[model samples]
Target: MSSLSGRTAVAGIGATEFSKKSGRSELRLAAEAVHAALDDAGLSPADVDGMVTYTQDANQEIAVAREVGIGDLSFFSRVHYGGGAACGTVLHAAMAVATGVAGTVVCYRAFNERSGRRFGQPDARLGGEPSSQGLEMSWHVPYGLMTPAAWVAMFARRYMHAYGATSEDFGRVAVAMRRHAATNPAAWFHGRPITLEEHQASRWIVEPLHLLDCCQESDGAVALVVTSAERARDLRRSPAVIRAAAQGSGAGQMMMTSYYRDDMTGLPEMGVVGRRLWEQAGLGPSDVQAAILYDHFTPFVLTQLEELGFCGRGEARDYVAGGGIEIDGRLPVNPHGGQLGEAYIHGMNGIAEAVRQIRGTSVNQVRDVRNVLVTAGTGVPTSGLVLSAG
Candidate 1:
C-alpha cells in the first residue's frame, strides 16, 4: 500500500437539507455545512487551518473560511472537472494532513444548481469563448451536441450497440437506486421507489436515456472534516479512514466529450482510478461492503461497474439484472439513494454517505460494512475513494 494510505481520516461530515431551492446564498450554505461538520467533529472553526473545494464552485475557500469564523489558513486548494473533483477534494485534504502542511482540513461543495443556473440547459456562451474548453465545445455545439444528455447519449448508444444492452438494463440501475432511496428519509425520493415498469415508462430525455436516469438538480452543500488518523481516533464520531484516493484522466479526454477514444462503451479514466485505488488500499472488489457510485446517469453506473472490475466488460447488464447490486446482494450500491434518488450536490453528498456507512450511521446501513467505495463523475477526468472504518 502507498504511504499515504490510512494516514488521515474523515472525522466528521455535515450537509444542508436537499432541495430544489435553498433560499440562501451559496456562501451561506457552505458556511452552514462547514460549521456543522466542525461541530460534528468536536472541533470549532478555530481549529481549521485548511480548506478545499471545486474550482467551479461559486463559494471561494477564503470566503467560506471567513463566514465560518475560521482564521488564517495554511492550506487552501481547488480541483477542476466539475463532479469529478468530489473525491479529489478529500485527496487534497488527506495529503495536507499527512504531510503536516495543515493540521485540519475541511472539504466542501455548494451550489444552487436548480434555481440559479440549471446545468441541464444548453448555454451558447460555452462555444463562443476563446479558451481551450470553448474550442473543445466548438467541435460539437454547432452540431446540436450541446447539452450533457446529448453528449452522454452518444456514448450510451454506442454502449448499447457494442454489448446488445437494452434500455431496461439501464432502468434496472434506476430502480435499484430508487429502492434504496425510498428507505432513506434524507433522500429526496424517500418513500417513492419505482418499479422496472415505471422506469421504462418515464419520459425520454434523449434516445436510450430517460428522465428517471438523470440525477436531479438540487441546491445544497456538504462538508467533511479530515485530520490525522491518530487524532481522528479521539473525535466525536467514528472516523472513516482514507484508505485510498486518486484522480485519473484517460487518453483523448475532453471534459465530458471524450468521444475520440476508440471504445466509447467504457470509461478508461475511471478504470485508471480504480486500479490505483485497489493498489493503494490493498483491497479488491470483494472487500467493499457497499458503494456509492456516482449516478449522474444510469448508463454510466453500468459502465463504472465494469471499469471498477466488479464484473467483466459488457457484463454489467447481467450483473445488475441478477440482483447483484441490491442492499442484501453481493454489493449494495447508493444506499443513500445516490445522485438519482438523493439530491445531487455534485457528489459531495455521496462522500458523506460513504462516511456514514463507515460510522455505522447510514439510513440504509449495510450489515458489517467495513469498507465503502465512492466514485465521482464519469466520462471525464474522474476520481474515486476507498473509505474504510477506523
Candidate 2:
C-alpha cells in the first residue's frame, strides 16, 4: 500500500456562515477561512507551508499566504472543474504533507459567487472572454442550455427516466437536506426545514427539476487543515484521518454537460474514485456509516448512490424510497444540509461536514460514524475521499 493511505489527516475544518451575500472580497473570505482553520487546529499562519485550492479560485496561494501572515509556501496546487475540484484540493495537500513536501498544508475555497459573480445567471463567458469554455458554451448556450440548472436538467431527466423515478423521489432529497439545515445554526436556512410536499410544490426551475432540486447559490468560504497523521494527534481536535482520496475523469467528460457519453445515468468518474477509495482504505460501502454525497442537484445524489456501489444501477430510487438519508437511516447523507439547503461553497462544505461526522460533532450526528464517504460534484470528472476517526 502507498504511504499516502493513513499518512495524513484533516485536523481542523472551518467555514464562514452560509449566506446569500458575504459583503466582502473573496480574498478576505479566503484569508479569514484559512485563519479560522489554522486556529481550529491549534496552529497559526506561520505553521502553514502549503496551500491548495480550485483553479477557478480568485485568491492566489501567494496572496492568501501573505494576507494570512504565513512566512512562505513550499507547496501550492490547484484543481479544476468547478465543484468537482473540492476534494481534490485536500488530496493534493495531503500528498504534500505525506511526502514531506510541506509540514502543514491548508486546502480552501472562497467565493462571492452569489453576490458578486452570481453563478445562477447565464453569462456569455466566465469573465466575458472567449476561451475553450466559451467554445463549449457557444454550442449549448445558443440552444437554451445556458444556466447551470438547465445543463444539469438534461442529466437529471435521463436519470429519472432510466431509474423510473418520480419528481417526489427527488423531493425526498430536498426534504432531508432542509431538515438538517433547520437544525444547523450556521446554515442560512436554519429553522426553515421543508417537507416533501413543500419541495414538490416549489416552482420548477427546469423541466423535471424543481427549484428545490437545485443547490443554493450562496457566498462563503471553507477550509481544512492537513498534516501528518502523527502530528495531527497533537492538534486541538480529534483527527479525521484521510483513509483514501482519489480523483477520476470519465471518457468524454465535459464541464457540467457530458451528453455524449454512452452511459448518462451514472457517474463513471465517481465509480473510479469509489473503487480506489475502497481499495486504499480496505473498506467497502458497508463500512461507511455516513456519507456526504455532493448535492449540486438532487438527482445527482441518487445517481452517486448508484455509482459509488451504495446500490445497484437504477435502484437509487427504491434505495431512497423512505427517509433513508436522514440521520437515523441506513446511511445518513448530507447531515449538514448539503449544498442544497445549507450553502454551496463549491462542495468544500460537504468535506467539512464529513470531518464533523467523523469527529462526532455534527448537529445531526450519526450513532457511530467510523468512516464517512465524501464526494465532490457529479455529471463531470469527480473526486471522493474516505474519512475515518483517528
Candidate 3:
C-alpha cells in the first residue's frame, strides 16, 4: 500500500470543450482528450502501454487505443459503477504503473450525454439487467426512484429532514460553484454565474430538490496520463503525485438508494474512502488547501465534507455557510467549477482540475496548494484521491 504512494504521478491532464452537445461521436471525444493529454505529457501514442476507463464508457480501451494509433497494450482495465468509477480509473492506472505492470497508462471518460442518452430521464431498462446493479435498481426504481436525481432525492430529503438544512443551503453551493466557473474559460457555465435567488426560483425536479441542485448532462471527455513520479518530473508538465487513492462501498449500500442505514445524515462510503486516503497519504483534511469534491448534486457536497473529516458531522452547513469553500477560504472546493458549474464527464473533470491545482495553474488557483483532495461521486460505492505537487 505504501509503495503505491508517491510512486506514480499524473503527468498530464486534458479535456474536450464542455458543452450541451459535442456534435461528435463518444469515441472521437475520447480520442481527442487522450491525444491532448499525451501531447501535454510529451509522450506519443506508441508510448502508452496501459489504458483504464469506466465500464460505462462506450469508447472501450482497445477501441480508443486504436483510434490514437497505439501499438500493443500490457494493461487495460475498467471500473464498475457510473460516476463512481472516475477516480478508480486513475487508481487502476497508477497501480499498473507502480507495480511494473505497465508504463504510461492513460485514463479517460467521454460521452455525448445530452444529445444521446440523458441519464436524468428515467428508463425502466436500468432495472432489467440480471446483475447486482439490476437487483439493486429493482429495490428503488420500482418505487419512483428511477432517475439519478430521484435516487439522490431519497437520501437528500432525508438529509434535509435530519440536519434541518434547507434549499437555500444547497443553493449556496450552486452559487459558489458558478461563481468559480464564471472565470473558468473551459467551464460550460463560463461567464454566466448564477445567484442563490435564481437557484431557489428554479423548478423542482423532486420534492426539496430544485433544478439548480442537479449537475449538467454534459457532452465532453477528460483524460489523464500516469507514470512513475521520477519519470513525470522530466515530462513536459509538472507532475501531480498520487499521494493516495481509495474506493469504498458502505454498509447496507444499494447504489444511490442506501435507505436501510440507521442514519442517513452522512456518506459512509465516502468516510471509508476518506479514512483510507488519509492513512495512505500520511495527511488529513487540514492538509488540503483545495478540493475537487464530486458535486453531482449540491447536498452531497455538505455530507462529504463531514464524512471526510473536513468538518464535524452536521457542522457542514455552517462550515460552508461562511464561504469556507471559496478560493481564499479554509478549503476552496471545485475550482474547476465541479460537475455543477463545470461539465460533468462524470468526475473525470474534477480529477483534471486537482492535477492543475497541484501544478499551480488552475483558473481559480489556490495559494501555495501543497495537497489537493479530489473525490468521485458520493452516496454510492465511491472513490477519492489525494494529490500533491511533485
Clashing pairs in 2: none
Name the runs in model 3 displaced over 4 angstroms: none
In model 2, the Cα lDDT at residue 326 comes to 83
lDDT (Cα, 0-100) at 151 in candidate 3: 76
Q: Model 2 over residues 21-113: C-alpha lDDT tens digits?
A: 889999999999998999999999889999999998999999999899999889999999888898999899988998899999999999998
lDDT of 3 at 348: 97
For model 1, residues 209-250, the per-residue Cα lDDT tens digits are: 988888889999999999999999998999999999999999
| Greater-TM-score candidate between 2 and 3 | 3
Candidate 1 vs candidate 2: the lDDT winner is: 1
Q: Worst ten-residue run, lDDT, model 1?
A: 322-331
Sort by TM-score, top down from the best:
1, 3, 2
**What would the per-residue lDDT of candidate 3 be over residues 258-286, giving only the tens digit for each residue?**
88899988889999999989999999988
Candidates arranged by lDDT, highest first = 1, 3, 2
Question: Candidate 3: RMSD over Cα atoms?
Answer: 1.0
